[model samples]
Target: MSSDADRDGDARPGPGRAQRDHWERTYGAHPGMYGDEPSAPAVRAAEVFLALGARNVLELGAGHGRDALFFARSGLTVTAADFSPAGLDQLGARATADGLSDRVTTAVVDVRDPLPFADASVDAVFAHMLLCMALSTEEIHSLVAEVRRVLRPGGTFVYTVRHTGDAHYGAGTGHGDDIWEHGGFAVHFFSRALVDALVEGWTLDEVIAFEEGDLPRRLWRVTQTRR
Candidate 1:
């Protein structure tokens, strides 16, 4: 586990580093901020994984382990990675308390960095809202490439992203690259073209539209397969 100081982002570069610090502080202030219920995307991802006989799942940007815990309970070994140490701490504690620690591992990982896993080592990868963070289009592409590198052949990748149709899409302070900041959080709203570009090297399974939260965040729940 990284020390709380390491998560403070004093030495890291880019706006992403600042976002990391924001998440760290946010998690510190409100542990389990997203609550414990598994996201609908996560629930659906688990079914896909299990149907494929997937034994392990890698969850990127796994804030406080809501979905990680759910995956574990559903009998998949889970690696939950997030940039926020405070969030992972809560996740770890919850796993231990629920006796799910044996199936769950936590790591402090920034998506801007390369994933720590070896190539073709992960059975599946799931990210609920990670790709829509304060990341450049190039950075998002790079991260998806990393996801491809780590996932095995025939592995599934399920992710969700806020889209241009969202109510908040044009309401926030623009940061270029389709990214915007609102209420101290930055989001890169996805366009359909961006989504199509990302599936170039993979088998695009589905892009289902959905809505969530009080703001009724408009999102695309995308599923693809490693080819």
Candidate 2:
């Protein structure tokens, strides 16, 4: 989550339209609420992907497409996935207007479910603060497995998550050990132990403290690779 508020602009909408109907209404009401610039984590992660020679990137919870547009502008083809129809539509329109439509595709997805892409089809997976949503430990692990399955050998998965040390960690209603519900959204904070567990069966490249937004969301910028 981009500083517990946004990831690449803190996309607050989540899950599918069924149970989490709030997200649909939220996106519909506040279309393009986020700024145009991608988050700082996404900016840095794009450099890492390019260094790894990644060509195709699948971005989950793409929100308003700030990071997706940045990746496309940097010459990487991006599949921008989000659950909100309004968010996806805004992203599509922006991509077309920016002349990056050929380099970008938008999809509505429930991250808790199976990813729609074919196995070993992508060069990298970029999930900016998408992991901190209402996902449980098992579901988070499963999502990682899906990322691993969808990436070609040597592909990278670059993502960000709010760290437990942030001021907001214990402020919200407890959903789990490190999960909190506040402002009508649930966020799962991460510790190093959880990070290690999340990167199992993969090569952990780095985990750094990343601060963002005015409140300064303390977060972990995690980079891993499929063996």
lDDT per model vs. reference: 0.91, 0.83
lDDT of 2 at 115: 85
Q: After superposition on all CA atoms, what RMSD does each candidate show versus the true structure?
A: 2.1, 6.1
Q: Model 2: residues >4 Å from true position, as ranges? A: 1-19
Off by over 4 Å in 1: 1-14
lDDT tens string, model 2, 66-150?
9999999999999998877678888999999999999999887777778888899999999888898777777788999999999
TM-score of each: 0.95, 0.89
**Mind sharing the TM-score for model 2?**
0.89
Candidate 1 on 54-137: residue-level lDDT in tens?
999999999899999999999999999988878989999999999999999998887777887899999999999999998899
Report the poorest 10 consecutive residues by lDDT, candidate 1. 1-10
